[model samples]
Target: MAIISIANLLASYKSPESKDMWERICKSIGSQMENLPTLEGMRKIVTLSYNHLHYYLKGCIMYLSIFPEDYIITKKRLLKRWIAEGLVAEIRGLTLMEAAEAYYNELLSRNMIARADDPKWTVETCQVHDMVLEVMVSKSLEANFVSLVGGSYEGMSYGSIRRLSIHGGEVVSEGSRSNKIATSHGRKNDIQVMNMEHVRSLSMFGPEDNMKMLDRLGELRLLRVLDLE
Candidate 1:
């Protein structure tokens, strides 16, 4: 039997008032540990503990780093690493590998690891639960960890937009600054120059049609992913 499964069972199988009986039950099953079904493999493993409800919940997320902090964590690798980490609590008759598998399955069953499909599973482009990311970024930002912010929008008084990205067939002109042309209805054209140096990520989609804005972004210098799109 694995220590972690034993740990988990010790952790959940019985309440403090029943620890003695639980340990006795574990000893009886210890020899069969190698063949026992994991919580993940079992059809059901209900919650029995009344304390620290989040022990399992939070534990599921601790290994999230296997995927990029902000990247969509794939189920395959996520499960693989979870197994490799030995984070699973031990059950009397289960191997650590077996226990970790059960723990993973349990997490999936509880929605601790839910649908987190990224854009084509692209690590850099993948995403996660907003609340999860929010919680993560809140802590990260407090530590001054910066991230990517994409696109262009011209708004009132041009607030604090420090970066500007001009993509293929897309143009955002500076108010009366360039003689760029875009024939249209019956209104005089207006442009807005977004701040290009203050925030973090400034991504350009593709096709560098407008080289004029290059200077604006070049000033950013801290640019991360400047795709030509």
Candidate 2:
């Protein structure tokens, strides 16, 4: 599946030099496959593909990290969020929405996102491959592009978060359920606090009971997107 996706991406490149670069990338991946585990080797391919994406497209793809695994993302919602986050810019004569749509199509052409099955046979939603999402999440963390709470990132500490995504049963433990928490990992020092003033987007994916989490929404003053599911 990784190879097929890489091949599809390569097919989308019209330049001979681009084709050669991808061909060499494929060979390098093949050489390392012998020494790496199956999942690791596939991650290598996806990581390479991600690194080779256009700068803007890379940002667009990294935004997908906000979504939980196997979450069906709607085209309209994703595009609108991109525009709201200023990740999408008008290109040539294209309007912002058109430009965003073009980015969506490019991602599809590269097989970075898979179309979700719809009973109406419409391509309105898509799902990110697990391996692909792994790479995205890794990159997002490395850049501090997003600070995720709950799920695998529970209890993690970050500095001046730019975008926040919460995935768990509750926003935070009742003891520290207020807007701020200790920034130091495993430390109760209140002097250093987790800052959300810079957070531009907040996505929450959990139960309706978690709605109380919004009471502290004032913390994310710069928030532009509030996705709840």
RMSD of every prediction: 17.1, 5.8
Clashes of each: 20, 0
Candidate 1, residue 47: lDDT: 20
Which lDDT value does model 1 have at 139? 30
Per-residue accuracy of model 2 over 1-229 as CA lDDT, tens digit each: 7778778767767686786877787687777687775877888888878877888999999999888777888899899999999999778899999999999998898888888987764659988998898778777877889777765456676777788787665444445412222222332212125666788888888665255457667777787888776
Alpha-carbon lDDT of model 2: 0.76
Worst 10 residues of 2 by lDDT: 182-191
Model 2 alpha-carbon miss at residue 23, Å: 4.2
Mind sharing the TM-score for model 2?
0.83
**Residue 171 CA displacement from its true place in model 2, Å:** 12
